[model samples]
Target: MGYQYQLTKVILVIIFWSLNEVIPIAWVFLICGASLPPLDLIISKDKYLAQFPWELYLFYGYAFYGILFQAEQHLIFLGIGYSLSRLVLYFQLKQSLNT
Candidate 1:
């Protein structure tokens, strides 16, 4: 997909996800189940330490960007996660192939 299209889709999903804060963390559970950490895990909680069942309710309160207490903190953590993953992917995927 084009970058703009992808971004718009992501924005919409984010908006939809944030629209209903009453889901009870169903997405968080599903995300964790799929070996993905939702935005909340990176900020106030550790991904490894989060329990699937119990954190479900708590995660429901999270915003689209996983803002439990502070939105900026959530955004910072999300950027951190993205940067880390990008670095990993760069080293493991691109750099490794040349080595």
Candidate 2:
């Protein structure tokens, strides 16, 4: 799971960097900054961390960022990537729990 998480982060960085031609540097920074906390939370085993609503925060944060910047397309792309990353984390966590 740790390796997978690291890989996901690396992949996301690559994807975002490649989008530098399209997305502004500020947007790229915002997206990456907004994503790290939730990713960190996903790997934590703390009971308090499990109880926090990071998902809602991530969604709302992205929405707010998009609206503020008036970038719906970037928002949508961020949503898709974010959802896929969360799904990967979810499955990894679930597998670990079941074992």
Candidate 3:
């Protein structure tokens, strides 16, 4: 099912956002009626690459019932932000390197 896919993607991807970034992302979802996950989100040695708090999904307060759904929507936005930020970083580095 789509739920499995979202969980897998969340577990696998390497967006590399800090814990600080995660709170805002969750807060955004929470504001949209998605409940916040537990305070102790993850127990990973590498929290940077882990899931964005599983409790929110468990609560399922907000329903992104469209084709994309909740986590997927967040993911698309995250991907866009990641790509744009990467592009900026690459360009800035290139310019610095040329100078």
- Which candidate ranks first by TM-score, i.e. highest? 2
Models ranked on TM-score = 2, 1, 3
Candidate 2 stretches greater than 4 Å from native = 1-38, 42-71
Tens digits of per-residue lDDT for model 2, 1-99: 678578658966885788687878556755764565465664554632244336657776777787788766666556655655555655666677779
**TM-score of every candidate relative to the true structure:** 0.35, 0.41, 0.32
For model 1, the stretches where C-alpha displacement exceeds 4 angstroms are 1-8, 11-71
What TM-score, to 2 decimals, does candidate 1 have?
0.35
Poorly placed runs, candidate 3 (over 4 Å): 1-71
In model 2, which range of ten residues has the least summed lDDT? 44-53
Using lDDT as the yardstick, the better of models 2 and 3 is 2
lDDT of each: 0.41, 0.62, 0.38
**Candidate 3, 1-99: lDDT as tens digits:** 465446544643333333436666643432222111111123222332332334334224333342345455664444344334334444554576579
